[model samples]
Structures are given as C-alpha cells and as structure tokens.
Target chain A: MKFHYPNGKPYVPKANSVAPQLKKYKNQVYSNRGMTLEEDLNETNSYYLERKIAIIHKKPTPVQIVNVDYPKRSAAVIKEAYFKQASTTDYNGIYKGKYIDFEAKETKFSTSFPLKNFHLHQIQHMEDILKHHGICFVILRFSKLEEVYLLEAKHLLAFWARMEEGGRKSITKEEIEELGHHIPLGLQPRIDYIKVIDYLYNLS
Target chain B: MKFHYPNGKPYVPKANSVAPQLKKYKNQVYSNRGMTLEEDLNETNSYYLERKIAIIHKKPTPVQIVNVDYPKRSAAVIKEAYFKQASTTDYNGIYKGKYIDFEAKETKFSTSFPLKNFHLHQIQHMEDILKHHGICFVILRFSKLEEVYLLEAKHLLAFWARMEEGGRKSITKEEIEELGHHIPLGLQPRIDYIKVIDYLYNLS
Candidate 1:
C-alpha cells in the first residue's frame, strides 16, 4: 500500500537522493515526494503551527562543526563536521497550553516494532518527560502497511523495563493496536496527529 | 566578575573544542569550561534534566548538508554544508505541565541589547507561542556586566511592534531591568532561570 501525500503523490524517496530535507521539501516541490515518517510528521506539525493549533518542531540533527570557511558575502560553508546523537525525542512543543513531546519512527517489520527503533537515552528522556508531566508518546508507523499509531510513552517505558528482564525485544502489533491511537493517513496535513492528541489529551 | 560553573570553575571553552557538545560535557568536565552563556544554559538544562526539574534544550544550528565523505567506517564526515537561517527560537521544552520556550542571546554592549540579534521570524514565532499560551521569553545577558534577565515575550513583542513605527532599535539596560525578571548569576545551574519563571508565570 503506497501512502500518498494528500496530493495523491506516492511517498517514495527519490532515487540517488542527495539533498537537504527541508530545501527538498520547499525550493523543489515534488522533488522529493517520497516522504519519510519524519517528513510526513513535519508537514502535519507545520499544519498545526500554521493554524495556531500547536507549536511543535523537529529538532535539527546536532552536528559537531569542526571547520567553518567564511567565503566573503556568502553563507558560511561547513568544511568538516560529524553527526552527534540526539538527547531527547525528536518532536516537542506546546499544544493547548500543555507541553507535548513525542518521537515519530517507522519500522519495516509487520509483526512488531523493534525496541532498537529507539536509543536507550531516548527512552530515558521520555521517562523524564512523563515525570515532568509533559504529554509524551511515540508515533510508530508500520511502513509496510502504511499504518501509524500514537503510543503513550508510559507504555513504551513499561515494555522497555521488561526488556531488561529478558522480555520480548519488540512490542507486538496487537499490543500496539490495543495501547495506541490510530492516526489516519491523510492528504493536506499529511498525518492528522493533533486530532489524535485532542482525543488522547481530552482537549476541546 | 567571571561567571563560574557551580563547581567553582570559571566557565571557559575547553582547550580543544572539536568534540561534540554533550559528549565533551560528560566525558571532559571542567574541559569545555571556557564557556559562553549558551554552554552554561546547556549545563543548567542538563542539571534540570537530571533532576527532572524541566525539559529544556538548545536547538542545534541548522545546516544544509550537501556532500558527505565516507572515508572511514567510524562516522560519515559532512564535507560540504551551508548554514541555514533558523526560523524559531533557540531553546524550548516543558516544565510543570506547561510549555516553556525561550531564546538566549548575549551581547557585549553595555547599555542596550540589539533587536538584530533576533530575526523577524523569531519575533513572530514568539507571538505565536504567546497566542498558544506557552511561556515565552528571551534571556538577555549583558556579557560585560555578567547580568542576565528573562524578559517576557509580550514585552519584546511590544518593542518589536514599535520598531516598525521608528521606535528605539534596542532595549535599554534600564528597560530590561525594569520589565524583565532578573535571573541571579549562580554557580550551580548557572542561569537559575526556573526561579525567574516561577515569579513571572505565577507558578507555585
């Protein structure tokens, strides 16, 4: 099942991909229509932002800039740098006066979402978010089925803790279906996550 | 007066600044000590994170990666990238079940903090944050004076609107002192902004 970006364009990564994510979305429309779960969420978040429904954004991937070359009157060129691991969940912001935090990920496996989809630090960060009273969850997309679910972080944490005791290394799809909210695949806003949030958080 | 990390060390950039920030901060303590307000904020955030006090983090500078060199297996090296303008505030997170967003900027000017330190989109972003009921502010540090203030977004927005009408281009120290909540310079949690937030937001 091919997921379509409201525009009916199939979500497929362009072959020989080599372009910055945002620019590919903007400067060149239809240039990179094969949207990743991250990209789809970005679009949905943008929708929420534009309508003043929410204020969430994906944090830029951290990079250790080693050498920057200032070439007169132009943007600074980063000559050398390396990707740094992120400390927290990817998407976070304010929604209806509440701190909303979550991470979106896609998995190829249809049976279960692997625990490896998240880093240990990310799980800890979500635990911290829960402790801080923020709304925390994971948007798990089964890429093969084009199915997405928003599972509260508490559930993820529970499973993660059990893993330490030799529990299943992944959360079965049935468990996800029972514990998570289904996010209908859509067009304009791409992924209608806020609607699920409104229901989940009991927001008007 | 030099601002010191709570552990009684003047915050200075560690001699060799090539390592990634979080790793450097963790592995080489007092190492990255020659620090800027940004680094101090990061440490303070880490402190808050550890204690589960607040969930704030500085956004990484956005860069557009164009070319990468996979010379070795260890890590992919970003060879060509350009700095991209950020469209939002630098730091944001959640605290006490509320959305908290802020930007920290330091200027050497003794009398005023320049408006140019922020881009137009950022000001608009703050306005949106306010509309959404998020706690939004700017951390202005008079580097020379070693004084910091958490100025509410409303105040900044007021001056920004006036700027278009040919008002003062900067906020005077007197103004910041009067309208902003002064954040005590401290050794632990250097900025100690949560105290200021408590007062400004009327949180118990």
Candidate 2:
C-alpha cells in the first residue's frame, strides 16, 4: 500500500513486518495485530483537525526522555527514552461544545471483541469522563470483517464489571451489532466519527 | 534544578552547556535553547493535564520522518527527519466551556520584546481563533526579569499592523505592562494561566 507522510512524501515502515517486531516485546504480544488501526485513526484525526470539525489529538504515550544528543543543532535526537503508561484514553478533544474522549482498537476475531484490548487506567479514565458529563466511547474495528463500531463507554463499563462476576470475557459480534452504531467511511471525512458522535449525543 | 523523570528517576542532561545549542543552516539559526519557551509551555500543559484543570499541548512542529529505525522491538526511532511549518498556533485546548489558543515566546532584550518573536502564520492563526470567538493570546516571558505577561491577541494585532507602517519593531516594556496582565507564579500550579484567562474572559 502506498502512503504519504505529513510532508507529502512517500512513507514506508522501517520494519517490513511490524507484527513480528511487536510480538518480540513481552508486553505487546497480544496487542500486535492492530498496528494499522492506530495509523488509520491518526490519518482520520488529521482529517478532523484540518477541516476544523474537531481538535482531537492522540496523546503521545508519555515518555521519559533521557540523554538527548545535539548533533550539530538541527533537532535534538532523543538518545534514550522509555515509554510511560498513559493515564487517559488514546484520543480526546472538544466537538460542538462537548468534550469527546475515546480509544480505538481493532481485532481479528470474527465472533467477539476481547476485553484485554483495554487497560484498567483507561476504564477508570472513562468513568471519570462519565462523571464529568463528557462524551466517551471506543471505536472497535473488526479487521477481518472491515466493520467499525462506536461503543459507548457506559456499555463498555457494564461489560467490564460483569467480567469480574464470570461473565463473557469478550463481547460477541452480535452484541456489538445490537449495542453500537456502525461508522461509514467517506471521501472527505474518512472515518465519519462525528456523525456517530452526533447520533449518540442526540439519541441519548 | 533537580527534576524527576516520569519513571521516578532523576533527569540529568549531558554536561555540555545548560543553554541550548544553535544550529545554523543557510542563513537561519535555529536555537535549541535547552528548553525553549515551547518546552516550558509543554511542561505547564502537562501540569494542567495531570491536575484535570485543562488539556493543552504543543502541536509537534509537523515533521517529515523520512526514515525510522526499529532497533529494539516496539521502539521506532527516526533516523532522518525534517521540520515542516505548522498551520496553527503552538497551544490550544478547551477550558471552562471556552476554547483557548496561544503562542509562547521569550525575549532576552531587557527593554523591548521584539516583533520577530512571532511569525506571520501565528498572527494569522490568532486572527482565525479570534474570528471563531476562541480566547487567543500570546504568553511572553522576559527571561532576565523573570516575568511573564499574557498579551491579548487583539493588542498584538494592533501592534503588528503598525509594524508595516514603519513603527517600532518591538513592543516596549511600558506598553506590555499597560496592555497586558502579569501572570503571578504560584506554588501548586506554578503558572496560573487559567486565572489570567478567567480575568480576560470576565473582563470582556
């Protein structure tokens, strides 16, 4: 697949096989398949920001940057840095006077979306957002089926709590279809998330 | 000054110069300034984000990452990158039901703050923000004096217009004191910008 960088130049990954590379990391072994989900969402975010429809941004995983090298003075190259676990969702912004916060995940499973894709901190963050009356949801993409669903945080939290009581560790495709709304891809606005947001807010 | 990294480790910069090294290419000199005013604002932003007061961040100077090295698993290092001009202001976010946008700058000059600290694109961004009813301003820090001022964008534009009419290339200290509000440093928040913001919003 041909892709362009933010500078309009062609973009190609240094590691040809990102899945295998990600699997080598002990912590990310199970979370390896959906690399493209992040890239696609990033592109979609740029689309939203450029049109001024919203100002959402993917917060960079907080990194403890140490030992930066100033080679001749261009940009400082971070020689050593360690990723720090983020305390909030992957994406957050303001849309139409409401705070919007969400995380995007993709899974290969055809029948169910596994609960392991989310972390405890993210769940707590969503609960906090809910308390503040902010709009929060997760965008789950079934890569094999090429379908995306906007699942509200309320539904997610209910399922999450049920898991502790021996409920299903995953939400079935049927459940997602019933509880969530599908987001269609378009030319101008690639992901069309705001449409889902509008529906969720107005309907609720 | 002693500081702890996000990982709870001590942060120690290389023993070169505390001042940021400058890289000059062609005719333009890019000063790293160890931590530029941009970096200070980023720290202040993190402080705000962590405390749940506001969410503001510096838009990474859009970079064209041409080559990245996947050295160790899960780590992507940019081997070659080039800076691309940004289309918007450095900082923006929502606070207390209002959109906030601003640029930060530091001037070494003791008497006057030079107009060259700002770019045309930034001025245009502030204009756009003002047009959309967003709260926009410039954060100016006089380093030698250890003082910071929040100058409204309207006042900035007024001076910028006069620049083309062969006016002074910078705003005098007296003008800043008269036209802008001084930001008092605090213990917990450090930079109490939102207080100044509240004053700005309520005054109007």
Q: What is the TM-score of chain A alone in each candidate?
A: 0.83, 0.79
True contacts kept of each: 0.71, 0.00
Worst 10 residues of 1 chain A by lDDT: A1-10
Model 2 agreement with the true structure over B1-204: per-residue lDDT tens digits: 133332345545333222222222211223444244554565677677667777665554444333435666676554444444554666766565566778888888889998888766667657656765678899898877878899999999888767755677799999999999998765556567888887767832
> By lDDT, who's the top model here?
1
lDDT at position A160, candidate 2? 77
lDDT of 1 by residue, A1-204 (tens): 222333334445334233655454333432332247767887788788878888888888788877777688886777888888787888888888889889888888999998878876688779878888889999999988989999999999888766655677789999999999888899968888888888877897
Q: Comparing to the true complex, what docking class would candidate 2 get?
A: incorrect
Q: Please report the candidate that would top DockQ against the real structure.
A: 1
Candidate 2 lDDT for residue B122? 69
Q: What is the C-alpha RMSD of each candidate to the true structure, in Å?
A: 9.8, 9.2
**Structure candidate 2, residue pairs in collision:** B20-B34
By summed lDDT, the worst window of 10 consecutive residues in model 2 chain B runs over B18-27
Cα error of candidate 1 at position A126, Å = 0.4
Q: What's the residue-level lDDT of A15 in candidate 1?
A: 46
